[model samples]
Target: MVANTQMDADKVKIMGSKVKVDSIMKVADIEEAEKQKMKRKVDKILAYKPDVFINRQLVYNYPEQLLADAGVMVIEHADFDGMERLAAVLGAEILSTFDDPKSDVLGSCAGIEEIMIGEDKVIKFAGCQRNEACSIVLRGSGNHILDEAERSLHDAICVLVSAVKNHRTIYGGGNAEIRMSLAVHDLANTVEGKQALAIEAFSRALRQ
Candidate 1:
């Protein structure tokens, strides 16, 4: 299951830094209330019986221990974009609250395990229900190379997606740009105003 809520002991909200309670017993009551609130949230999550828990926010030690004890693999602090992509791939819902969780809302995968990629450990989810969705991890010796690689990869993926969606192909090697430049220049010649200069300049820029 994918969740965005922070998995931690709930804190009591007071108006000021120092509050005078009716009795010392009130302090104990407040602490117990916090515990109960956290326990309830944990219980609600466990009721779903998900094989793995993916949280977009932090999973504090207390609740983390409980989830660990339940034999549920916990992945915490996943960014919003990642959670969205993961949920899509897994065919799961992004649930902020586990209350009244739908039976079919959980995502499925063949397995999840920690794997070493370069010097870092990453959790790999295999055999997602949405076979079309996949993740690629890029590694590089330097940040600049990695950034450039990522930009190139993004452009490539966007092109691929556009081609797939439109079922069309175009000429490579700046052929399309040259064609546009030629078309714009042809239009510029027929224009009878100062806008012709702007159009001609744009055409030349495209050619370059």
Candidate 2:
């Protein structure tokens, strides 16, 4: 996966414009210049062999056709947050320029494919380096339900991150709680001050 962070077609066109005599340029010349500029950008991107391309802005048909020919999948108008998450999941560094694309900066995935989810077409990336990439497709009858589902998903992800960082997994059936409560109770008995009472209270709460 490689992303062209600069998705400004107008900027490329501006750079392609030539300053001619009498400040006049033929329409054909301008069009050809733009096409050449787009071709260069596309060629540079294709050289990276990115299985997927995430564009922040709309991609024109010309470049899209080129990518298709190269067997590269593209996701246009991707959100910034999505792109950041993708980079993390792929263990890939985001490069702003193709001037010197190192292997370390390129991301690889086992595969990418488009799948039909209901009436919509969804792109799925598989076997990323992190193996933690996920996509949530929400189906709701109304906007309110979708919004609520999104908020719930965000909260669930936060909890998952916290759990992963802690590197602890406890079994169900309150076994962990019982063990923690007992440990805390024992520690409280060793305390020499009134603070022990607070500790005991916490331990009891855990047991409950």
Candidate 3:
């Protein structure tokens, strides 16, 4: 996926690193040759009969058009992290070559479709092999609002994860503070010294 597919060959051996074309006719011939090579590469891919193809690198116009014409959804320039996670979620491997693609090496999902979200096109994958695979889409009128929402959501998720791992629970929304303050006040009443004054001060600070 991470190759310049528009080039004549994915791995080219330069005979003399500095060859110059003589005229416009030569340039045209070279371009035509590269186009034909790309056509062959695309044809090889079409023979696999894939419903969708995702590339971590660019898929230029020519090959992109060829795949589209063959009714294959081509998604190019996929982010590396997302691609890695997707491979794990779908129980598939990240392949460098398609010389011999097998059914077991391919990923599958129930469906993939494009949806519009706040003026942007987004691809949605449904019914993934991993039941835990999911996505959260946040929409807002402004970027700041969306950023704040994302931060809050991330914090909430972290809290839930911590609770699951630690198996601990505590009151939220200032209730814990009030309870601590009351407990500290009760302890201060049992003592008689400047330490009690300090404890009362600490409890008062927690109330504030």
By lDDT, the best candidate is 1
**Per-residue lDDT tens digits of candidate 3, residues 106-198?**
677888889998788887877777654557888888999999999999999999889989987877899989999999999999999999999
Global lDDT of each model? 0.88, 0.78, 0.76
lDDT of 1 by residue, 1-208 (tens): 8988977666666765886789989988997888788888998999999878899999987788888899987899997887888999999999988779676999898988899998888888898988657789898899999999999999999998898899868789999999999999999999979999999999999999
TM-score (C-alpha) between model 2 and the true structure: 0.61
Range of the 10 consecutive residues with the lowest summed lDDT in candidate 2:
5-14
- Which ten residues in a row are the worst by lDDT in model 1? 7-16
List model 2 lDDT by residue over 25-140, tens digit each: 56566666777777798888887777777776677788888888998777887677777778877888766677775667777778778899889887777888785566778999
Against the hidden reference, what TM-scores do the models get? 0.73, 0.61, 0.62
Candidate 3: the clashing residue pairs are none
Every model's Cα RMSD, please? 8.7, 7.2, 6.1
Give stretches of model 1 more than 4 Å off.
11-18, 22-24, 171-208
Model 3 misplacement above 4 A: 1-17, 23-25, 141-144, 163-208
Ranking by lDDT: 1, 2, 3
Per-residue lDDT, model 2, residue 202, is 98
Better of 1 and 3 by TM-score: 1
Please report how far candidate 3 places residue 94 from its true position, in Å.
Answer: 2.9
